[model samples]
Target: MAKNLLPMDALIAGYLHEAVQDAGITYRKLAAVTGMSINRIGIILRQESPPATLGEIGMIGSAVGLTASELVERAENVARTRQDYDLVANDSINEFPEGNDADYDHA
Candidate 1:
């Protein structure tokens, strides 16, 4: 399932790493708090296979002082941002700049 997803592997993994960095916890400490192996934690931050379960995700949120819902929102937001970017990129219409539309143009 992940293979078919947007932003691809390292994207999500990289975001996870960024989240940990932003969370301000050492990997070992996070692993200890999440009750998972340092290796498993690495997999999550690294975005490897055997992806984390929802429970693990929740644990990560707790470890980072984020709620599970907030964490999911963070992840979901990545997809949303990508979609927004794509939409803007594909748009062919030019948005008139402020004064450019000052003339009564919309008859």
Candidate 2:
């Protein structure tokens, strides 16, 4: 259930860490504020495990001065950036043959 929030782990961890820092809070403070276990917060911030539940994300975000939606968007942006790099690196953009475009009529 929590895993459904996002597919990527590292990006979300990065966002969490950055937000915590931006909010000028330590992991211990964040855990205290969010009512989450300090070890859980540490693990996620360290990229050992991602925060899976929306509830978890919301608590973390509230402590770090962001919203669950904002964090999700940040994670999505990171995923999109990674995808773009993967496509470019693999040359998938050129996978379609050069002559293929001519086979389809332009409206």
1-107 per-residue lDDT for model 1 (tens digits): 54322243344455567778997899899988888889988877777776666687678767877665676666667767675443232333356666778674877
Assess each prediction's global lDDT (C-alpha) against the native.
Answer: 0.67, 0.71
Cα RMSD of all models vs. native, in order, equals 11.7, 8.6
Query: What TM-score against the true fold does each predicted structure earn?
Result: 0.60, 0.64
Give me candidate 1's TM-score against the actual structure: 0.60
Clashing pairs in 2: 2-52
Best by lDDT: 2
Q: State which candidate has the highest TM-score.
A: 2
- Candidate 1's error at 45, in angstroms? 0.5
For residues 22-91, write the lDDT of model 2, one tens digit per residue.
Answer: 7889877787888888888887777764444678778888886789889878877767777543313245
Candidate 2 Cα deviation (angstroms), residue 59: 0.5
